[model samples]
Target: FSLYRSYFGKTSLEYHLQTLENNLTNLVKRNSELENQMAKLIQICQQVEVNTAMHEAKLVEECDELVEIIRQRKQVIAVKIKESKVMKLRKLAQQIANCRQCLERSSALITQAEQSLKENDHARFLQTARNVAERVAMATASSQVLIPDVNLNEAFDNFALDFSREKKILEGLDYLTAPNPPSIREELCTASHDTITVHWTSEDEFSVTSYELQYTIYTGQTNFISLYNSADSWMIVPNIKQNHYTVHGLQSGTRYIFFVKAINQAGSRNSEPARLKTNSQPFKLDPKTAHKKLRLSNDCLTMEKDESSLKKSHTPERFSGTGSYGAAGNVFIDSGCHYWEVLLGASTWYAIGVAYKSAPKNEWSGKNSSSWVFSRCNNNFMVRHDGKEMLVEASLQLRRLGVLLDYDNNSLSFYDAMSSQHIHTFEISFLLPVVPTFMIWNKSVMILSGLPVPDFVEGTSLDHQEQQQQQMGLCRQESPYLTGMKNCH
Candidate 1:
């Protein structure tokens, strides 16, 4: 006993007890974890049962709807068949009655002829025989008319039922499934300044009940997955029956991405996305804002400097004074990118650009802080803003000039449309909406508004850093080599 006590000391006892306690704690933790897992599995089993029942009920409901439709159609077709049978029987019965009447009349004529033949006295026999013979001849001659015109072969053959197509349809019936995706026909799509008409085609059009169109403004992003996930900005139009849909009240000069969904009783499938853009805002010169000597023609699109032009009373909106020959457009632009072209038709001296509504109309457009313009005076080309001018290199043979105004980005650029060359760009932080302004000292200029921005011009816009440098340059004083041209208007 003394030896055993020495081997198993107080430390050994405590270590053994500690090991058992740790094992017990681990076992308790594992038991609790197993219980939680069991509870979750039981809950999942119950959910599965509910889902199964729900799906079965839906299946039955769909089947019942199909059956009900078939039943209604059957009733309608039965009524039609019964109506035809009644009409046919009525016609046959009338024909039978006519035949019976004809038979009875013939029998009576035969009896009269026999009785005339049986008469003993010669005179009585002669008179009776003559009348009877006449009666007999009339009855025999009219046999064709009295006979019923019933045709034995006229059994309701015309009204026979051919339900082969319906039988095939019924045999092919099955549970509804999602329709195939639709395809957007980009070539067939058209757009105007404020509307886009999206055209599409579907292979499963017969199965599809309706269509859903979704669109959102495109911001030059190529990641379609990310764009589709950002549904907050998407606009949805549902219950469309036609294959093509025209979305009105859209922003001009803006790009949009569209998607079409073919929907049925089961579900829906989306088409591949398509990108479309709208033309620039359409505008025409406002005659009310034309200068006194400036003549407008061609539906207010062409302007000319005429010496004998009719003079009118000047208003606050009209361009007045002897040296200012200008006009403003009818539309004011506050947002979105816009593009327009000017047909400079032998016009050597002209000014083209945008100006604020409060800009001074009595002075040259670009001579004040509220306007910006590219001017051509004799052989020199320059851009003027806020009483300062900068010489910009341009072709002397420039016949068509392109102007792109990006209001949201604060950019206004000019290009030689004939040669596709960039002329100049002005960066302005606009405080209000602006309208297209034009000035001419000789000849005429035609305005072409509502044009899409050319691809070359769109890609030629300066980058952020270059635009910053250019903006800084614009903020400086006028170029030293540039000199102010005298107002010849």
Candidate 2:
């Protein structure tokens, strides 16, 4: 039993020593953690001290600036008051001198009159009295003329130091903060073919000293933040004083993103971006490229087949052939998207399309490799490219034809303007600049350019797969009358 007690005591002592060692380790770990926390707290205190000093210095500097401004204004006002006092004193001294001179003249005149009264002899007295009376009359008139006019306005009533508004402003002075961002007035903005007038409004306009306008072409970029961060693509117009600005020489038929910044000495804030788009470029039919047998009227926008050939100088660009009666537009399109409409007024036979600048002018458009056209010969409608004609479904009574040329996207689409129906689209890989081409065998056709793309047209457009399907369907069967127009043209 004694031996058992000794062994148990020894085990208890060992357990106590292990527990003590664990407690010591825990205490050391806790103490180390407290020391680390204290060091961090010390660092925070030092940072706080430095920040407090920096803010204090900034406060003193701002106060000194305010004081200096007040001192300068006070000095200016004091100088002005001194100048006013000097002017008043000088005028008052001049008036006093004039009064003294007038008084002395009156006294002299009175003395002369008294001497005249002293004369006793009748004739001498009469002569002396007459002379004295004349002298007195002259002296009175002279004194009236020499008297200085006293103006009540010279009391400095008009010169006022009304600094009540300024005092209120000074009292309201505080730390200035960045102005609130401007809001783009999208509805108020206007755009032309080559210019965009951006209008904006600011909530804190009084605090803003100037405005900055930043803009860039919007090329289907959904992430505006990334687009704006690209500094090289942006165009900035700084120090704009007015709420509106007009930017000229912009690309026609293009979309742009704009931001206005309200800036001041305190700081600046940018407005939310606004998207604006310019209209399609305005173009007229080129009379210079018209066939000699064709008649152009209505500012060269309407073309008609003329039986009598008109007198015109023939150039290499003019359409000159037996059956190739065609005309090209005035402008060449190489970039951007454009939309124009052709008014087919009582025209049964017509071809509307685009052609390369180097396209043969003396040949029927769409019969060569350089042009693509949507043509209607009598009741048959077809799209022809590179001498290959494909039949397409179109309304027989279609009056207006819409053409959309997306040069960058390499697309040429035709639409039924009245019904907003998609007629056809050509996916061409254009390697050269192209111009609008028109050919008519009967009646007249008019063009309307510089029009915005219609909403229905945008929504009704087919996707890539659908477009490919439609293209394949249109090309599935070649037109049997392809050789028929060979003799007609």
lDDT of each: 0.88, 0.86
Q: 1-489, model 2: which lDDT tens digit per residue?
A: 889999999999999999999999999999999999999999999999997798789889988998999899999999999998899989988877887877787777788778878888889989888888887776657545446566566677687778899889878977778999999999999988899999999999888999999999888889988998999999999999999999999998888999999999878999999989888888999988999989999698999999797677889999987666778899998887789999998998889999999888887788788999999988888887777788788999999999988787778889999998888888878999899999988888999999987876665445543764567466645566565656446
Candidate 2's C-alpha runs over 4 A off are 1-56, 68-164, 311-316, 462-465, 476-489
Top model by lDDT, which number? 1
Q: Which stretches of candidate 1 lie over 4 Å from their true place?
A: 1-167, 216-235, 462-468, 471-475, 483-489
* C-alpha TM-score for every candidate: 0.68, 0.69
Error of 1 at 100 (Å): 16
In model 1, the worst 10-residue window by lDDT is 480-489
Q: What is the lDDT of candidate 1?
A: 0.88
TM-score (C-alpha, index-matched) for candidate 2? 0.69
